[model samples]
Target: MTDEEPPAARRGPTWLIVVVVAAALAVCCCSGVIGLTVAGSAGLLGR
Candidate 1:
């Protein structure tokens, strides 16, 4: 039997996982920025 594996099976779902992780990070960063902006604005108004 040949030891070499097919390319498709060797690289299964790696791209999909990277995309999902990037999307999650993007969402988290956006929310964090928005939350910080709101908090800063509130602080300024209170001062």
Candidate 2:
């Protein structure tokens, strides 16, 4: 039998972790700003 080097394992998730975290933070910040604006506008209009 021939001895061969084992194939290297794939590391797709390690690469994508940074992208996922950044995207999540961006979405959270955008939504929070939008929500605060809407709530503030409604409150001002209600008065």
Candidate 3:
């Protein structure tokens, strides 16, 4: 075989896909909290 180099390493682990998805879901859930906080001061939504 030739002396060609292999591809570079990934930034994260492959098995962490589940964890990554869960983390993304957690962020989405937290976004609703942020929206609530922003609108809470404006009295758009109930506390």
Candidate 4:
């Protein structure tokens, strides 16, 4: 049998990666805002 390496798998498209990163950032920002609002309302954060 030949001792040759197999071909590597291809990665996803650049646009898809950008969209995923943007979505992740949006979710993170939204969650942070919500958390801060909740904390403020609960008087945990000083005004």
Number of the top lDDT candidate: 1
> Which pairs clash in model 3?
none
Clashing pairs in 1: none
Q: Which ten residues in a row have the lowest lDDT in candidate 3?
A: 1-10
> Model 3: C-alpha RMSD to truth?
5.8
Best by TM-score: 4
- What is the descending TM-score order? 4, 1, 2, 3
Tens-place lDDT digits, model 3, residues 1-47 = 23332222332455478788999999999998998888999898866
C-alpha RMSD values across all candidates: 3.4, 5.4, 5.8, 6.4
What is the Cα-based TM-score of model 2? 0.62
lDDT of each: 0.82, 0.75, 0.74, 0.80
Q: How far is candidate 1 from the true structure (C-alpha RMSD, Å)?
A: 3.4
- The candidate, 1 or 3, that scores higher on TM-score is 1
- Reference-based lDDT, residue 19, model 3: 88
Instruction: For candidate 2, give the lDDT of residue 32.
Output: 91
Give the alpha carbon lDDT tens digit for every residue of 1-47 in model 2.
Answer: 23332222235665578789999999999999998889888895465
Model 4 regions more than 4 Å off: 1-12
User: In model 2, what lDDT does residue 39 have?
Assistant: 85
Better of 2 and 4 by lDDT: 4
Clashes of each: 0, 0, 0, 0
lDDT of 1 by residue, 7-34 (tens): 6656667878898999999999999999
Worst lDDT run of 10 residues, candidate 2, spans: 1-10
